[model samples]
Target: MTVQPGRRLLLIGSGWGAESLSRQLREQTNPWQVTACSGRQANPTSGADLLLWLLQEAIEPNALDHELGLWRQQWPQTPLLLVLPAQHRYKRQWLLERSVEGLLDQPAADAIAEALEVLAAGGRVIELQPETTSQHQRRGQGLGHRLLCSGVDQIERELEQINAVLQLAPIHPLQRFVLEGRRRELRMAREVLHLLWGQEPIPQAQASAPAEPLQIVLANRKGLTVLHTVEERLAHAVASLDEAQPSPLLALEALLPDRRRQLFEALLLEFRLLVERLQADPTVASSLWSGQQPLLRERALQQLVGAYTQLPKEGALVHLGDALVSSSDLQQEDPELADLLPSLLALIEGRPLLIDGGLQAPDEPAALLHLQRLVSNWLIRNGELISRELLNNCSGWPELRRAVLLPDLLATRQLDQLRNRINSAERWHTLVERPLAIYESRRLLFDIQAGRVEPTMVCDLRDAELRQLSWWQQAFTLLLEARDALAPQVELLINRVGGLMVLLLTRVVGRAIGLVGRGVMQGLGQGLQNAPSSGDQRS
Candidate 1:
């Protein structure tokens, strides 16, 4: 079966009102798309795509088992909740009561829409029909379109907020991001995809994204190119993240405080947001791959290992480039990534970065080198430590302070085995317009050390936030002291020789001083005497 690019919701019942509902969805798309199929098709379709097998009545056990097995393959950990029509009693409380992932009944347009939201969030659900639930009438609880619409809108809005937050965040390119920073990548990706929607813009957003002419052309041609490319490479790189965990091994909601439901909501928002951004701007793909911090993110630092593997020229240049550049940072006494500085400024300016232009003789090394060095140095220093925490105060070197807190070195094992399968930079070309920009790298490294890695897994997400605040507080203190030190010195270079001239004339009594007045009178008389003598001499 061809894999659909969207949230694939396959409906498998030809008869009844489903036909009408499908048409309605296609006609007025506030929710999503509908793809319907027959309930009983031979060699049933697999579950990588969503499988909506309508069980109006009892089916052959063999067929049911087969569907179940297929579901296991598509998303094994996620549970499939069964939906049932309440009146058709089967006396199988075991089936009804058993812990399934989710539940649905009669699935009207609203129900279908809600189900899609659940599915997109990686929610556990096994949609059941009236027969399965043993119900007669087609109503468990009626849903109002107004209510469902509002609910979906709120979810979408939250997603928008998350998307903004994620995008605003400084990040490594996608490839290097996954390679060097797994948790941050997941956090960013999850937030981005969570903001996607169909009919409207992100609600309650301070800045409603400007509407653009739909990229039907771009979506069809380059979009297809981008999608296919991103998919293939992502699949190749999946192994690195497999152990690394884009998320927890368990459902986010399984943890606590309404059982991680809030976390799940946030993650859902993130996923939609990412999807929307990609749809809106596919150029971000390049940044995703090239910020090659993971060095391990791909099999080799070079994404196109196979294509350019034998072309020793590119490989040699890049390897030599990295070595010469990174070594410069390593040997410096001050931790300044001078090389990658231009890349940082360009990133701030939001301009396209041309890796090779041969435009002019170089006056400076590239700033991308600085970022790369920063990441590599972070890795090496981290590798030497045992825990995230270092055992010293060393307040002057903030990175070192952060290093002691993290488990020495990056968690390389988390990157699954799929790294070798990826062999091209073409996959990431789509996202390159926005080069990854990491801010406060030293502090982030410190946070990694300090056990404040990312989106809090436990209900205590606030703790991570506090830890971040504390780091900034320390940094601010340092800056504040530096500010005081740098202020210009003042010794009040005062000479009082002209001090009397500066006094207020109103305070004068010499225009108030009687003695000063007499001296002025005497000088005036002398001048009068000299003027007469001058006239006589001239005659």
Candidate 2:
């Protein structure tokens, strides 16, 4: 299919995807005669009516400027359209100075098509205009405001450079801290400038947008049934434990041997008081279950467990108890603890009783099961309250919705990992052993409970590196651009010269040689006609 003369378009580079922009353009209904080439291969002789520059790689402003200059010289009358990446930091004024007719950042097909139509009709288009009317008004208020705005812009640029370095390079932790501190200072300065200029403080944009709420699906009846059964067993165990422990002193006496009961009574009482304090508050139980309110939980747990264990202080095994109580005192006070220490530790870690090298005590298993049930019930009862607390902390409904629907948006592999951690005893034990793993699990669990969802965070290292430019780097870039900018012009000149040389060889030299050969043939013919035949001479 032949396109009209004006519809010819030369696509300079492949777009963001695997497919070339030319192919994508051809697929559209615009009937454009698309010619695709890499940046190195582009030349003036393409006879294209429009030039579309697709900049997928990170390019410095000076480099871009030089390239644009070369393109403009090559195709003086052709309209230039630039398609930049969404995160490109190129200035609008720079592009306008180069006479770019149209600009689109990470544009869709429809947007690209519209821009093309507009450019073809001698119109201009630029999508990224962040300057608002209010900002313009503020900028024009006075010289002081203008000066402050300039200072703010400089600080922002510095911050951008620092951030780019942090994202693109792996630096020492100390160096990273220094860089981050510098960024904070710059941010403070920017804020002060904004205040002085009477401009509204800019809201910090979230790194990742909140994920959309996932559609609710039918519940798995079999899974629910299993959960219900586990709940029933846990409830039964709790009731039994409650019956066994009519009072804290009596419970301690039952659990400890007679010889050591008096020696550890005071310590046991203190531990019991701490546990009772935490247990009495419904919020603590809910927080523990849902992994919310970490500060509250941490402080409360510290008094009983020496800032680590969830168990009462007195409940720690003799060897495990530290500075608060001597190991010798604990051992002398309770010899029976030697036999039950492993079981108590296992329960605290939330490990199953049936695992290899795990706890074998029937009472300890019952106690662990009862604790689990108690925490779960507390969470169930206060679920709405916790949800409300979580929602209240979010910026808006979108954030809350993202929190609630996070699990549904997780990839299959991520979902499988979560399931394994929950269902497999081995996985759970492994997770418990790793502090980082436990912290991550708690964070994820908190998000699930709060009903918040966010997209996965990512950084384009190339883009980041490209954005970080120093004075020397800019100078070096200009030198490189000078070399690159000369390449096409040199090639074009050589091509024209070569074409003329070929014409001289084919048209002028060949014709002259043909004429000489024709004259020789004519002279031979004339000589034969003038001379007598051999047969006639013999007669």
Candidate 3:
């Protein structure tokens, strides 16, 4: 059956996936032109005339609402169908009921075609039947499945090489994170090498050897059942050890005993505190905001954000910095943080506190999770008492409140205090270019946490190198533009240099040719082929 002549189908997946889908669609005899872009990169209004979008849910849950909220504002009637495992659960039912069409399983080719059919029926929620026909299966599994199946051969080869390297570093806990990253990179790289091999991985990152480890767990590997768990692996290992009765500490020492034990203790302690705090009142989520480190380490954050991509976390913390420097903002009832106040009301980094052992050092992911509510409530609302207000005047996340509140305060103060309180070096430092460098830095921190990236190996100089490259690019662009002003002088200098060289060369060439011609003339006359000359007397 011929599909509609020019029906719109919005796709919001990664570039490679989109390209593969587009190629398959183009081969089809009927209409399948995209009405607009659907991924994180393209805004909704970019091509909204079609009034329909088949968007993929590429964002996280908390951020999803905000991203979708913006999408709805542009294409109000456009429909979204989330793609995830049917087993993967999300509790955002309020959002699901309103916006989502349904879930699409991990992969399957006819799914794209089915989505098109649903879009044709109008943007209402509809269930799509899985095409069991072998033909449909063939169509669905065309390029991606074939590529995945074939590429597995190459990935296995690379994985083997990595496993060999990892064997030498058994104590490296973060090696797991780095390996996981490499495997992910291998997946992403395979997609490119198979499809767009011309495009290269960022040079600096490639040279740096990932700066971290990929987190691969033996027990809780995805696609495994409950029976295949870390506990089970440990149980078997422990049983073997129990029979041998080797030094218990020696075994621990052999397999990342020091930092591993500390991290485990921190995680266990934090999780316990999280459960207790949440159990007391489910709304208290201050534990989510990270203070010791920003999102996924600062380097990765830098890479991910560009001039346009602002950090809400930074926006949250800016005002707190200002409040510390000022006293006028504090009212009689509302006091600024100081030594006079109880330590329970203390602020750590940019996060507010309950200041007991529960809020002590924790793993990066869990620590950051503790800050989310602090961000939503504090940063989103300009540090106005939100979750605190919601749960009565409890001092749960005052630090986050202050942090988000500060960006605006800083913005306001920057304009007024530009001359009074700014440092040139610091300004340039903050305004570093080369976004991927920032992202790498963040990845480094994340890797460090995961036991992939070494903290000592993560040099501040790498950030400087990226920043210098950014400056040089800008400077070179300016140089190129100034070419018009210097063109006449440059051209004149080239001509002068060429003219001198030409004059010297001409003298040597003229002398050699004259010598050769005279020799030839004498040789012919001496051989008795004498001819009359025009200048007879001289001849």
Supply candidate 1's per-residue lDDT for 270.
34
Q: What does candidate 2's lDDT look like per residue over 350-434, in tens digits?
A: 3444323334322222333333333333322222222222222222223222323243423445434533433464343333422
Return the lDDT, model 2, position 319: 21
lDDT of each: 0.36, 0.47, 0.38
What tens digits encode model 1's per-residue C-alpha lDDT throughout 1-539?
A: 23335545556566676677556655553434456776434454543245454556655545555766765565555434344444434333234333333445445567655565555554433344322322322233234433444555565566665556557647546744444354455445545444442222323222322221110001121222332332332222222221122221121111222212222223223323343544454466345323322332122212211223231233343342232223222221212111333433334334433333432111112222222333333322322121111121112223322222223222333111122212123133212211111112222211011111122111111233224434544465456556666653322224342465556443675466777889899999999877767667899
TM-score of each: 0.21, 0.25, 0.21
Where in model 1 is the C-alpha error above 4 Å?
1-5, 28-31, 40-48, 59-82, 96-100, 125-539
Cα lDDT tens digits for candidate 3, 1-539: 34454365566554566667766765676657653354444534444323333344434666766766766776666555555433233332333233544344444556656655554554222332222213333345546555654566678799788778767746477877788789788877776765742332233334443322111112211211111222232223222321111221121222222222332233323333433443354333344422211221222212212213322333353332223213222121211101111211121122233322355321122222223222211111111111112111112333332322223323433323422222342244344422333424421221112222112222222344435455655465455557866998899999999998887778877778888999999998777656655698586
- Of 2 and 3, the candidate ranking higher by TM-score: 2
Cα lDDT of candidate 3 equals: 0.38
Clashing residue pair totals per candidate (backbone < 3 A): 77, 7, 44
